[model samples]
Target: TAAPGPQLFLSLCLSRLKFPSDLDELRELAETLKFYKQEHYGYVLLLYCSAYLYKQSFAIPGSSLLNMLAGAIFGPWEGLFLACLLTTSGSTFCFLLSRAFGKQYVVHFFPEKVALLQRKAEENRSSLFFFLLFLRFFPMTPNWFLNITCPVLNIPMPIFFSSVFIGLIPYNFICVRTGSILSEISSLDDIFSWGTLAQLLAIALVALLPGALIKRYGHAHLKVDGLDGDGRDQAGRHRKRR
Candidate 1:
């Protein structure tokens, strides 16, 4: 079994919001957010909270909920862009946070999982870019660890960002589309959260598949190199024909 993504998503989602028994509290919280004056701050804070939960096994829950809220709060294009920004911005925060702490921190927060991740990173050091691409594509790999380890491993930010942006496109589109529909649908059925989640996962596979195939088939055709003519060779070190 691939595991039921919906049940997993729902279980993860509900786990985060251990709400009050009273509907009044719910209403109050929702109203406060709706009327909150510092909209951007709240938005960023929401993202920051997501970053805080980075160590949690199932984090898609928070990110997904935030997108729906972003649509409601910011509306359409602005909301869409803001959602994406929050995601990446939160990721940046997690990256730096984890980097500062190092592997010991990862082991503390996520012993079993982070160990697996560290092993994977070591295995993919030879294909650093593709390794990053794979992680960004599926997102099971905690991005927090990636951000922290990248600098430690001397992986350039340019390579990281290129991989992040390209590999994240499908996920971004999924969130954006979900937000757009959420703007129109004010109810659970209309929200289509379950369906949208499934669709997005499927779309993720669909989007990543082509790229994977192309890379697998055409890796030789694509060469990654530094600006120097001899990529691995040090040009500045050359003492011209002495």
Candidate 2:
């Protein structure tokens, strides 16, 4: 069973003193952020950027919270741009770090998943761009999991970065838009209403279209290449038999 809201709130607040669990606290934060933005704009920008990168690179929590804050601070479009840029940069850092230090340890821990991902990588090497984009778009895999495992699976850097940047746009825009309206929100329910979910689902469907098309069309070339090799082997074997 789930804990009571107050109990969960208390536990979360105790663990992270700055985590805003209620609308009142979020409103307060918004006001404070406005003052800081007016007073110490450059310094605050640097701090926010550094903190965002550090959290993502180290696999820490608070990215969603930061995205919300970005919407509140920078407004929707600017916040979305900044969030996407930082997310891609931070994920790239994590990817490179995992390749160097954590790949072996991560592979040891998640052997089956790693093997499955590697097999998928081999099978989709030609259309890996779309595959990675779909993976990034959906929540089937966690970002941290992908960051570490992609290196082990030998996915190239360009594909990984491109997917992260493009795939994050829809969800990032949602969170940022929520932030832009944070002051008017009365409860969590308001933020994730049915309307919001439908919009997100529509966006997710759009994101998947490219991957579906690639799967449908990209296999023909691979099949033709395989057939050519098979024909050569058949002719060689017939010559030997004769």
lDDT of 1 by residue, 1-242 (tens): 23334444346445643332343443333333344424334443554345434522222334555555555445546655765665665555555555566646545544444444445556567777776776666444444445554545556666766776566656655655555554455577754578656755765775777567645633453232221133112211221221
Count of clashes in candidate 2: 0
Model 2: what TM-score? 0.69
Off by over 4 Å in 2: 1-25, 184-242
Clashing pairs in 1: none
Candidates in order have lDDT scores of 0.50, 0.69
- Which residue segments of model 1 deviate by more than 4 Å? 1-61, 107-119, 144-154, 186-242
RMSD of 1: 14.8
Q: Against the true structure, what is each candidate's TM-score? A: 0.51, 0.69
lDDT of 2 by residue, 117-139 (tens): 67666877887877676566554
lDDT of 2: 0.69
